[model samples]
Target: MSSSKAGSSLLDGSGGIQPISEPKAGPRYIYYRIYTKQGALESNNPIYSNDRFISRIVSRSVAPPHTAACLKKHIFRIEKFELSTKCTLYSSLSDQAPVEDSARLALRGISGPGVSEIDPVVLVVDVSDAKKRSKVTSVEAKDLVEWSPTRRYVYYRVYDEAGEISSKTAFDDTDSCLGRVGTLCISPPYTALSLKYCIMGAEGVSPDRVCNLFEDEGGENTMKDGDTVALLSDNYPGVSKEEPLAIVYALQKDPVNPSEQSNFTKKLIVTVYGTWGDYDHTWHTTKAGEIFHTDGILLKKPYVTDSEFACYAAINSSGKKAFIHQVYSSFG
Candidate 1:
């Protein structure tokens, strides 16, 4: 008989009572190799060992077009069954409904003497996980002071403490409230003059100097040659007066050493009149394409839990089985 047939016969009824080798005692481990979908897909998948929850494997967006990357290896030490257990894969998407069989993965532990021996696994999620991480957080809005006013806009200095921020809202006059000197509503059709004054004031640059930088003969919609553009605007209710309306600006980097800049390249400025739930606000830029945020709270709050904003979780390859956290979907 061939080696395969002979091996099968060893487990047959006629071969009963054959001598067997005992499993070695002591520590054992299972290492995993999981493969996600080809593009950047956001996923918050949990991993289990021996039917017990051990860690969560999350994929991050490293590039555009659904391309994603996840933990290379998951190492779990045996606990009850000689430091080894069968590993089954599960994703948060399964919580919604019955997951397709093809989306699931089943892996059996392979035992070895030490670090050299390991069990590898590949897991796939039922749905593509593509949620971008939120960068909004609680902020401290201090004061608002006027700077310069153009023919169609007025500039003001906004004093803000919580520098970097984010928002999902579209930039519009509605849903936003910019506190004017009269505490009047600075709503839609936001004049270029209003945007310029706020940003120039925030930059501590003289509002009158705006004319020196650029000239605009065009009406409300046309931005001056060197004038800042409004990016996003919204009104966030429940904001306390102590932390009133704020303007978050993302400035251009100093080309010499861009790496030294802060993550958001942000500057927080306050509006002159204190902003309330109805107070409107707008984020402005001297040039187009620079990022900015408004009408949102800070990323971290005193009472809110981390899970609310945390979008990605990665498992450490060490024996401790530690977890690493990353902000939003940009993979680290």
Candidate 2:
């Protein structure tokens, strides 16, 4: 009957008062915060403190072995939310490109330890409606053309300063006039500069050397670096196996003296094939069926194709100077 408290007897059996030991460390976890939005993804400063926040997901994989598709499934399983066909996953609110289903989360820089609340992976589930709107806001507001995602091949030939075609079979086969440099796979939104870099890599040409790209071997149509493959294909639709895009190696030379401006007398006229709205103030809005006249005085040199616009200064019909973006107009 001298049974003091059973709990006290158990404690005393171990020692006077053995300190409670901490539990062993558990598996590290990675955390991701998800949100659902109903509009186009913003490029910057997206609202995060809103009620759109869905839930946080915990994962044991530090490197995040989950692919985007797997994460989508996990989100659906945990949240019990059904996603539409238009729904896409973005790494952040500002991500322009949707995360591919096969892309791993770790490869997209979305992995971290869940020790603290800081620096958790943020993902946006873009649930924008894909149905076309019934109402018309404005003619200019409507998107006339969209960037295509279909992959296409571009045939090209490289030429030396002497106009001799390169015999390198790095691409496909070769013909007499145009030796097949190679077939470059071009998807929409691909720039001429990017295609040029690909061609240079295949040809083993030094990047420092100036290379001129032309739609034809005659060099009548100059392909600016800022020009998209879509625009080039639209302008020159006949690019095929029989006729390859020409690439000429330009030799570095002294800049033309300002006193030598008298020799530059070529007047180039541009026609707008499609309506171009002025999003950026650098150029004026142009109508679809209007002719744009140029004074031939290139305030900015057109040869600098690496520039964002690849446009030169020209006098409009009203005698006012304007910077015409090359993408919106076709040279006549």
Best by lDDT: 2
On the 0 to 100 scale, the lDDT of residue 98 in model 2 is: 58
Predicted structure 2: lDDT: 0.45
TM-score on alpha carbons, each prediction: 0.15, 0.32
Error of 1 at 132 (Å): 8.5
Model 2 lDDT per residue over 277-316, tens place: 1112234434454555553443443332333545645444
| Worst 10-residue lDDT window, candidate 2 | 38-47
lDDT of 1 at 196: 37
Candidate 1 structure, TM-score to reference: 0.15
Alpha-carbon runs more than 4 Å astray in model 1: 1-21, 24-27, 39-119, 130-332
